[model samples]
Target: MSKLSKLSLITLFFWIVKIVATTLGETAGDLLSMTLNVGCAVSSTILIGVFLANLVTRLLSKSCN
Candidate 1:
């Protein structure tokens, strides 16, 4: 009903989505690198990309605040 309440619900939904998505990504990454033999380099690169994206977002958010 209120603005803060709406924002809280949105935040909770995003947190749940993120948890599921992260779990799915972990499973998919293992399947690709181990089951499909995609190699460690490819899998590591994918992980590094995720890390860098998070780092950049954190930096940007901190600067905005």
Candidate 2:
């Protein structure tokens, strides 16, 4: 008996999007805290709040399938 791979096009797309989003998020965070002089503590708090809000919204949303 042999096992087969389960990777699909959708899964690959999801990973690509995740990587891009993560890179963009880091860049934006640095810009906010350093370039804009927003201060690290405040910027971190704002970013964390946004992340939590998005996470909650996604969790509460219905599945597309």
Best by lDDT: 1
Q: Give the per-residue lDDT digits (tens) of candidate 1, residues 1-65.
A: 99999999999999999999899888878987999898888987877898799988988884765
- Estimate, for each residue in 1-65, the C-alpha lDDT of model 2 and write its tens digit: 22323456667789999999999889979988999999889888989999999898889889843
Clash tally, candidates in order: 0, 0
**Which parts of model 1 have CA positions greater than 4 angstroms off?**
43-65
Please give the lDDT score at residue 60 for candidate 1.
Answer: 80
Pairs with backbone N, CA or C atoms under 3 Å apart (clashes), candidate 1: none
Query: Candidate 2 has which clashing residue pairs, if any?
Result: none
Q: lDDT per model, in order?
A: 0.88, 0.86
Q: Candidate 1: global Cα-lDDT?
A: 0.88
In candidate 2 the C-alpha lDDT for residue 21 amounts to 94
Candidate 2, which segments miss by more than 4 Å at Cα? 1-11, 62-65
